[model samples]
Target: MKIVKVFLVLSVLLSITGCSPLVNNNPTKVETSSNGSYKALLFVNGMELQSVGHTANESELVVGEFIGAVNEKVDIEIRPSDELTSNYLEEGTEIYSVEGNTKIVLAKKENGDYEVFE
Candidate 1:
């Protein structure tokens, strides 16, 4: 009986230790509006990250690849804007137009992560 009790206690302990807590690794997703002219994602440094429905300017930048299940190189563009549309939101993120600011960045990768620079 004692041996059976020990085994039961050991099994219970093992079960408790074997289960791992669910990990929450939800990354923040930033997206640009359908119209790039109206809404564009920008870095805190004022670099355009993603835009659509707009003419390409002379300046375009190739930034680091997006950190995700699939590694994809992201093209960050630089557009001229008169003033910032919003601030005091996410740090290290900015928008150029008063309409909206599309910004990118920030993630804690289990193995690797996307690196965004000024």
Candidate 2:
């Protein structure tokens, strides 16, 4: 359930923000629990395929800077959904792909494409 909500929110964000690559020192959200309200601030290390992200309560929100979430470059891509993304590759329907050096947040669209939230 939480995953679904996060995926949806990511989709909306990708549409609004052209999936630009991200860099270190960016403000990312931390974990918190609450009601129906859901949000995500995730970071993926493009070099190591490691990532960190969490949801926050509608009110209790915390902000901090990431030291080195992404190693070198930061970018967001709008690739075809069929393209193998990290975890999604195993299930062929997952929304995230973090197996490679470049870690990216993905949301599966109705058209079978992905909205890469970098």
Lowest summed lDDT over 10 consecutive residues: which window, candidate 2? 73-82
TM-score for each prediction? Answer: 0.22, 0.21
- For candidate 2, write residues 63-110 as lDDT tens digits: 222222222222222111212323212223334442342334443445
Report the lDDT tens digits of candidate 1 across residue range 11-111.
Answer: 99888767744322222333334555233333334443333322212123233333222122223222322122121112323222211212433222233
Q: Which is the leading candidate under lDDT?
A: 2
TM-score of 1: 0.22
List clash counts for every candidate, in order. 4, 8
Positional deviation of 70 in candidate 2, in angstroms? 22
Per-residue lDDT, model 2, residue 48, is 22
- For each candidate in the order shown, give its overall lDDT on alpha carbons: 0.33, 0.35
Off by over 4 Å in 1: 22-115
